[model samples]
Target: MPGHELRYDVNCSILFTELPLLERPAAARAAGFDAVEFWWPFAEAVPPASQVEAFLAALSDADVQLVGLNFFAGDMPGGDRGVVSWPTRSAEFRENVELVAMIGAATGCRSFNALYGNRIPDIHPGTQEETAVANLAFAASAVARIGGTVLVEAVSGPQPYPLRTATDAVAVLDQLLVERDIRNLAFLADLYHLTVNGDDVPKVLTEYADRIGHVQIADAPGRHQPGTGEIDLDGQLGQLERAGYRGWVGLEYLPSGPSAESFDWLPRHRRGGGADQTNEGDG
Candidate 1:
């Protein structure tokens, strides 16, 4: 319970995969979480209006606040990280930007994660970077209308993702600030990915605390529940708190067992940061 003081939000996209997509929000609420986050929930950049309504209705019915969301990353299960850096997909990314903004307006969700896509084999790296910068600028501007922060994350994988460290992601943020004067852009400190990519998490927490717009966690070695892996999540979270990050800590780990059963490490009261309010029992 070292980091019990921090507010936590369930990443329903990962945590409640056993249930259908629409039921995940309610499942989180049932597990005693008041807020949740997710990756792009649909198969396409813009789903049909009916699908959109159903997705929103699910959140409303569950009565959970959406604290974070990702812009439409291309076919994730098919190995696509994002379309922002793909020159051919600029229009798709921009269109999704508008859709994401609309969703944010409806849900009061302010933090948006924009995954920088992987390297293209045929395209020049310079061209990809240029496309990424322009797309990020567009995303930042669009989300700024709703008082939102656009998050850049360092992903860990073998697919040639460009941003693989806190410094790598922050460099893009810095470029946006200095060149475009975009203050709404920030880093998404995903500890599991950063650790997998060999970043010194403690050093990152100390050096770039202020630049972190959102935070996500899972245990390292295997992206499982906190106590099941090697990362000292509590200590790192304690450092994050001392360094003044008061944002929602997203539980983005894959459940080691049943989703409901995997939350034994986090008491129900602490999950919502309502230590004084008594819950029936821990989930």
Candidate 2:
């Protein structure tokens, strides 16, 4: 009930895995959501134009607004870490910039999450960090032209990701903003990943409220629906509101049962895009 005051968008990439990528938007619309976000829609960094058009068409047909998207993280299910920061992958990342920016411009998407690449053996941290900063500046500039912000998040995993804390992420944003003069980069506060890394959730919520560009949530331990884990999400959502964040709150959780069952924690009226919930529910 606490987060009901905030706008919510389901992350179709993880939430509706039971449906095909092209079918997920309609599935979400059926389940009462008209705003959705996704990881890059294809395994390839630059999916073919037809595939991209089909995706956009699906969004239009389902009548959902695209709220957020990830820059390709490489084969996520096959264990490939992200590539934006990798020395060898810099060229690959460069190729996808305009493609992603085009999607943002078309869909009015404002938030882009650029995952930091995994560390490779014997590769200097300075080298990777420099590449990442430059790459982020490029993305920031592209989206900024459209009045959008590029987001950096601290992913909880092995030693691959150097950004293991909010401080780490903010530091990257500050450095890039200062050096590149790009003002649109911001932190993506993903509560589930931060909690997995042992961050003090309350402190993160209060201290970083003004600096966050977007927020995503899942219950920790198993990364399932809100009430399924030890995370005090209701309390955190209330705190998020009190801290003065009025941005969209993304439901990035994986469902333990059916994705439709996941919303039992949220009231039916608040689940879909605000106005459409009524007709969607009735339909």
Winner by lDDT = 1
Candidate 2 local Cα displacement, residue 277, angstroms: 14
Q: Rate the local accuracy (lDDT) of all candidates.
A: 0.88, 0.83
TM value for model 2: 0.94
State the lDDT at 51 in candidate 1: 94
The superposed Cα distance between candidate 2 and the true structure at residue 109, in angstroms, equals: 0.7
TM-score of each: 0.95, 0.94
lDDT of 2 by residue, 182-278 (tens): 7788888999998999998899878888788788899978999888999998888899878776677789988999988888888777876552331
